[model samples]
Target: MTSTENEAHRRDGADPGHRHLFHVPPADGGRYPESAYLAGNSLGLQPRATRTELLADLDAWSRLGVEGHLEAERPWLPYHGLLTAPAARLVGARPSETVVMNSLTVNLHLLMVSFYRPAGERTRIVIEDTAFPSDSYAVRSQARFHGLDPDTTVVRLRPRDGEENLRTEDVTAFLAAEGHTVALVLLGGVNYLTGELLDIPAITAAGRAAGAVVGWDLAHAAGNVPLSLHDWDVDFAAWCSYKYLNSGPGALAGVFVHERHHGDTGLPRFEGWWSTAADTRFEMTPVSRPPATVEAWQISNPPIFAMGPVRTSLELFDAVGMPALRDRSLRLTGYLERLLDEVTADRPLTVVTPRDPARRGCQLSVRIGTGNANELTKRLRHEHGVIADAREPDIVRFAPVPLYSTYHDCWRVADALAATVEATS
Candidate 1:
């Protein structure tokens, strides 16, 4: 998996576009024309065929009028359903328990309303300290809505000294100790910063053992890795479809509420017309009896236009499959790691992401000492054409996405790093 094993890939020093699935940050053949791109973990490259699919949707809408809802091959009425099977498969859930709906934060709110039921002393929530800001906001708001102070109700876990990442043991122990008072355990499936993959299945089991509801924010994990939400007995989950799902920015997100929660009429939910059972939906009945599955969470008419790119993206995912993509992801990331190790052997740089494939995805966060990490990353982009991202004081995050990125992309970026080090020194 090391770069040395693939000489041509490492020795050629070519541009990443040649190894990527799609376009790179287009260079005008002006500066750093051979830049290596490794930023897909933040925003993925647009699929070349996405425009064609969007055009088809626009054309169909122009020609079909309102009839498109019921008449199109993928009728607008069941458009959300059409995306469910593939989306569910991508996340390892039953089709019936999944629904593509509001954005990530909104879905998190909806799931929290249903799952975060505080009673007696069990009124707190356990979340990571470094969760995405949006998630932290939602968790705080949920606590406020429930008339609890976030300082007391929200449990924030941090990494150990000299450790840039959270260990599974620490997470499990937190749940074991605080599960009793925790109303819900909400954690990101894959950390956005360090690209650390949390042990979701074991965490879910631990939360359940502590007698607390478990939910996951799969924003980073959905298409980046395989998920078995249903089999893991995950009580609920939410995800944005835009990332690796390739559904475009601000695309409709998705939610999964376990089937066991379906008939638990005792669990409260904020409902609307779309959640009303299908048989009586059009009857315009006054009584609101929700559908028997996760569709019960829908609060509005589905976004038909957003489904087009999702359908196309899911098709690509189905074609390649997660197993194959993850395999390649490991190889590409491992190659990059080895290259980085060699280049930084004498430097004070460290890879923060987990070395184990089972504990991480495609991302590797590089921490630099005694240098401006951000400036170096910027220099790498402007001088060498290596597209990576910097996080605050001293970390640079790079991701070699599988479906599109090749082993050569890894080496190109590694070489660019070596060159950048030489230039700065």
Candidate 2:
């Protein structure tokens, strides 16, 4: 490793170079030791601890059966709470303000049920033009459910005519102008496509100042970046554990609701058996009394199997801590960007993600104007054992996670990208 790389590895006090902690699969039909797995922004690498953790839950189910809810080793009844504090720490929330619950989009809908209250002329919902399709679908459907037209009730924010990413000033200005009309302001904490880390605190404050309830889809930001949802005074936020959290594919997600909103039983929500206070949950009271915490938004009991990987992953995160991980992530992604610049010097490649570390996470999205980005991505995987995700048109996203990715991995990706572009060009 180079001196810079050695310094980065030592500074974090954790070496991702020893890849044994992750279950990296062989690429090119077992010809390579492992594929350069640079797609953590989509799905994180599975931790080695997952199997053991999952088996423990499975064993409890097998041995204790119905009694596992009370008598199991981990006690399935309060299993979700085990993740609450660690998850809250990850997002800079209090334990009571956060809860590990349903899927990402599901939590978004749940939070919106409580926060998206439209009345009078303030019937609009504000979101980004490049929001994940699922978020747009949720907003449009919510608008329709409220007897409003999305075309009129939805305000989509976009960059200036020639710019690729939205500026903090632009977002604040738009919220200032249309805040009165907007009932809810929801956006991605990080742009999934461009890899741009939005200014969450600034946007949240602006939205709130405009008298709009602000929330965020933290699917890409939750574990990848440092967030202070509580400190930022965000109304609500949701994220999945399958990304930088290192949980398995389709693992359970999380939600955050500020403590101020928790006591307001006047807020409308869709409650369930699990939403009631845990102590009185099984009493089956005639009246529905929901807890004054984020758990009140949960629709069902915890999914132990789905949450197993989360428990294992969060333990690792707590041990390493987000501050150190983020520090390493900035340097690692910066190194990747520098390598790409060197290799693609002669090519008409554009790094679509923000160049500044403050505006990006671990991902560096490149637009390979070569007209065959998908082809190049496929060639990189099949031929050179480099794995990166290809978006529509010509964008390829590479996320070098700080947990299980190494500097050598970035070098391999740059070399493979250079070779693939040369071959395709």
Local accuracy of candidate 2 as per-residue lDDT tens digits, 131-195: 99999999999999999998989888899897789999999998888788989999999999899
lDDT of each: 0.82, 0.87
Cα error, candidate 2, residue 329 (Å):
0.4
- Candidate 2 stretches with Cα past 4 Å from truth are 1-18, 29-32
Tens digit per residue, CA lDDT, model 1, 1-425: 23452683553344232234455566422244544667777777677777887787777788898998888766787777778899889999999899889899999998888899888999988898889999999999899998999889998889998887888899899888777888899999999889999999999999999999999999989899999999999999999977777678888888999999886788789889898987788999887889789998889988778778878888888877998888777877887888888878877778889888899998998887755878988877776667788887888898888776666667667877777776666
Provide the lDDT at 308 for model 1. Answer: 81
